[model samples]
Target: MKFIHAADLHLDSPFLGLTGLPSSLLATVRQSTFTAATKVFDQALAQQVDFVLLAGDLFDRAEQSVAAQAYLFQQFDRLDQAQIPVIVSFGNHDYLADQHQTVAYPKNVTVLGSQVTTKTLTLADGETVAISGFSYPQRWVASDPLPDFPVHAATDWHIGMLHGAVATGSDDHYAPFTVDELLSKRYDYWALGHIHHRQTLNQQPPILYAGNTQGRAINETGAKGAYLVTSDHGHLQPQFFSTATIEWATATLDAANLTTLTALGTRLTDWLASQPAAQPTLTALTVTHLQLDATDLTSLRQGEWLNLYLRTHARQLKAAHRYLVSVTPQVQPQALTAPQLDQQYWDQGAAAVFTPANLQATFGKLAQEPALADWFTQATQDATLRPQAEQVLAELMGKEDPDVS
Candidate 1:
């Protein structure tokens, strides 16, 4: 009873990292889906996995690109030929808004229809696996839907799949759920998604999120891949596999005492060399750096040459790793720590800024400002969310340059 469990294949995801991707990587925007889907298909074939579950997010948007659709079809074709069943359901990102139509997928594809229900897949050997799945009908479902799932049902093995959050603290407001509530279902395995970071929600019965196929943004950094689940003497766990064509990485070069760009270069060189070397055929890399101070050190190659400088070092990195460095300095730290970099002072400033009253007052005053009128109007309606917004705004304002040049 082995299956390849993957989710959040945000096909044709515009760009893998973030806005303003380099020109060289720009053309691959629409082709990201194809690249990632191709890898998944190849991996599935190599692993000879019996089933594949696309827990949700089959498209980046409701009206996904034709190129993306074609690419998906091609992958499904391969799966069909291999006789592996691919089970799919629409996630919030690819929900009803998803205008995907007019493309003929292989018979092996099981596009789960809307409305929460169970689909039973009986293998050729007469062993049965029931996938009790549900999908996001809209962009947001604020209510607790975990209670809606079938509990302790009769089945060989029940794999419950849904897309939401299961948390205990204030962060639970993000998606809202309780592990104890999920436990009521008593399913054999839970293949989940939505929160795009690989996590194990329940070790007792094994509830897991495979995370996004590839890191879609800078915040979605680090290793991105799928999971392979197998039962050993009726016990199971997941093995994380790296199938991402392009890897997104971030390294912060502390430009503190190292006042020279040459030092920064060598520092960056060491960091790049440190990245775990992956397979030979992988996509480019984006490296963002946060620097301090602005010293016109001659060792630092200026303009286009800087990238080339890093590229030269990147090439000398591990043999299997191929990457493009994306450099971003975090407001140049010396500037931030400077007396006026932010009206930002030292201990007192950081403390006063984080204080609740100061944050609320600052946010309330800023909310009254003319420039923020529209955003203010929209935010006022939700009383529960007001404090969060205020806290965030206060942080931003507190961090602003005390002297605006």
Candidate 2:
């Protein structure tokens, strides 16, 4: 039976990590979801797949943009053209019951409800493929979805499909299921989702989460995409397919002892050049222990020539590949003391802002007068602005600053 398995197509992403990129450029990055999904559709059509199984997280959130819906329709339309059947379960991100307007699945699509539901498919060999699943319904599911595993048709094979957090004994606030319960049913294939990383939990019965269709952020790192499951009458062998067109590269140039912007730029450029030709998109970042003495990211954004060069470079490396050159300051291990280890964040800002070099290099330039410098220093004193000042200092230090409130 030919079937395509995929999940977590977070389309029209807000792109929180991506910075300095013009709103237009950001829009383009978000648009890559369509391209990625289109590739999956193309893969399915090429395989002449009889059905498509979406384990979960079909969209980023319940409040997904219309563009996401539109793009999904375009893909489901392609599947519909192939006379393919789409069986889906709602993941934590986008559960159908939570949304105001139900997503319009293609005529051939079958979305399982909040409770256990099943659809029986009659294959050409007269064998039946029974698919059962459920939706998240809310942000958290307290019960184990495995115990609710629908009874299968006693025909050829029964596939238990679900979107949940799987664990034997744990209070994890996601979809939690048990291996013992799953084994008891003995389904031919167990299609799973929710976890971004891919792993083959069971070999005896092929069970898998296709993983997020695309990596939305740096944290969802490494290869992201779907799994292709091939099963005959006896056994099933699942192969992971990397369908993501965008990827994150945590490129670090150790500046612990060495210095100079040209050297840093060279290190970054060399790393970018080292990227394989087949890599569609990459975010190259540099981590410096000592704050670098060079034109900062602000300068790169303001200087017309530098800005033009960076954009041209991103465009030059294939229209799809985006090489984001971001820099972050690295702190030495064992540098932070015990009291500082967990100083409630407020204290860290007090320390970082009062650092000799930072006070001079950053605040010393303020207004040329001691009082103004004192005032600039005092503005960071307020508990309210301490967090903001810390973030500003992060920007100054070339650290991947957390999102400003």
Candidate 3:
């Protein structure tokens, strides 16, 4: 028996943290989710898989995107025409709701409900498979759903579909279950979702997360796709296939002895020329071993230099089919030298100033605005805030030696 397991399609979800993108590139970004999903269906048809399992989050219910809805209808029809069965289980983003339930998917598609239910399929080879899963009733399902899931069914193969996370001991919004608990069910396979990084929890029974179909942000780097599982020697084996048309990557460029913005631009162009992706790539560039004067460093720190470089080097970027999302400086603390003030004192000052409370207070009324509030929440996260603070300190220290530039 063969089937494809995929999740987190996130169809028509807006590309996050993108700005100043060329209109053509923006259009591609907008359609990327759909494009990635189409590839999954195309593969399903080509492989002639008996069934396809979409673990969850087919689309963002909050967005209520018309295009996403229409695209699914069209694709499901395509699968129906090919006589391929599709099993869908909606996750947190597109949970089971009365409004969505009003419109039914095509006859070929079986959408799992809020309660744990089992669907049995008979493969062409006379193999019987039982699939058990459930969709989220609301935004969160606090309770462990394992108790509701029945023991392995009396079938040739039993596969479990789940869109959730591992137990964290506290309040877990998603359906949280431990690996041991899942193994206790004695299912042949577990097609998991929710987390956007594809990974296998168990090898024997093939428990795994298929990850998101496409990369929407820089953090979701590398090849994003789904799994094609085939029964091999009484064991279910899964293989990953790429579906993402636009890939997100982070690369560190060594800027040692490179001084001017023009030199950096040339280096970046050369780097793009050397490392080419099959699909259009969006890169988050980090410059290490960088040495720049006060003004240049300030420009890099403020993203002014990177923006200017991008604007000036449009031809090179287009030729390489690459876009620089951001350029971050990865300089050491010792590199940010201030003749007047000690590094320890500067660090102490930063420690006092860059706290969450301080940042929230500084943001003041901006927090009241929804869009700004969301940005503020992410921007104020420790990972983001620490780098920004370091950049600011570097800029300030660079200013100490104004004549050096």
Candidate 4:
């Protein structure tokens, strides 16, 4: 039997914090989610798969996007016409709620309830398949869901669908479950979601995450798409297919050869001309070993120089099918020193100051604010925070004492 497994459609996701981009690029970004999703349905129809499994996060209900709702209904109806079934389990972002129940999808679509239940399907060839999963009752489950799931059913194939993360033993707000727990169920395949990067957790029974159909942020880079799984012998094999209309990437440019901004511009243009992309690619570029003067380097890092370059070389950017999302100097770690102190002293100081407890204490009451608190929580977990901080400190100290470094 053959089927499609996909998750995290994130339909109508407002690609937030992208106001700096041009209107034309912004329009493409806005439509990218829908475009990516359409490709999944198109693939389903073309491949003539028995059914499609949408593990979770089809859309964010908070956006209140009518377009997203309409689009799903239209796509489901199309699938219905082609006699293809779709199984859906809502994730945190699109948790099971009253609004979802009120507006039912096409008859062919089977949306799992809030409680763990098994949906059995009989394929055209008279083979029985069992899919087991649950939708989030609310935004956060905060509990282990493994206890609710039963052992593999007495069918030709048993697939376990889960939309959560691995139990980290702490701070697991989603439906947490362990790989060993899932393996105990003895299911033929495990389809996972929640995490946006596609990965295989097990090779034997074929447990994997389909990832998001489209990347919504800069951190989610590379080809985003679903998996086409086919039963081979006694195992299910999954093949990845790209669906993202646009891609995100981080690249570094060596600038040790050029000393002037004029030369830099020409070099950047030539680089863009050489590396043409198949589709629109949003790039976060870092210039390393830059030979420019302090003022020119500051201008480049601060966006003053890059802004002029982008405006002047709009045609070049379009030709290369790339957009410079941000340009920053590569922060090379340096031994921060003082007239009387050594690198060891600086390291010791940083170790004491950058501790999570100390950072939280420093944040103090500002942590009461949810937005800032979340940012602080992530910041505290950043492994490179101390090194980056040291680099910044060294740069500041160099202005005061040239002999310090």
- Weakest lDDT window of 10 consecutive positions for candidate 1: 370-379
Candidate 1 residue runs with Cα over 4 Å from true position: 16-33, 167-175, 254-257, 260-263, 266-405
lDDT per residue, candidate 1, 116-166, as tens digits? Answer: 678788876666888877766665556676766787566577887877676
Instruction: Report RMSD (Å) for each prediction in the order shown.
Output: 7.8, 10.9, 4.8, 3.6
- Give the range of the ten consecutive residues with the poorest summed lDDT in model 3: 370-379
Q: Give per-residue lDDT, candidate 4, residue 268.
A: 86
Order the candidate numbers by TM-score, best to worst. 4, 3, 2, 1
Q: Write the per-residue lDDT of candidate 3 for residues 204-271, one digit (tens) a residue.
A: 88899999999888878989999999999889999999999999998889888998877887788898
Worst ten-residue run, lDDT, model 4?
A: 370-379
Q: Rate the local accuracy (lDDT) of all candidates.
A: 0.65, 0.66, 0.85, 0.85
lDDT of 3 at 394: 77
Candidates 1 and 4: which is better by TM-score?
A: 4
Model 3's alpha-carbon lDDT is 0.85
Q: Report the number of the highest-lDDT candidate.
A: 4
Better of 2 and 4 by TM-score: 4
Query: TM-score, each model?
Result: 0.70, 0.73, 0.84, 0.87
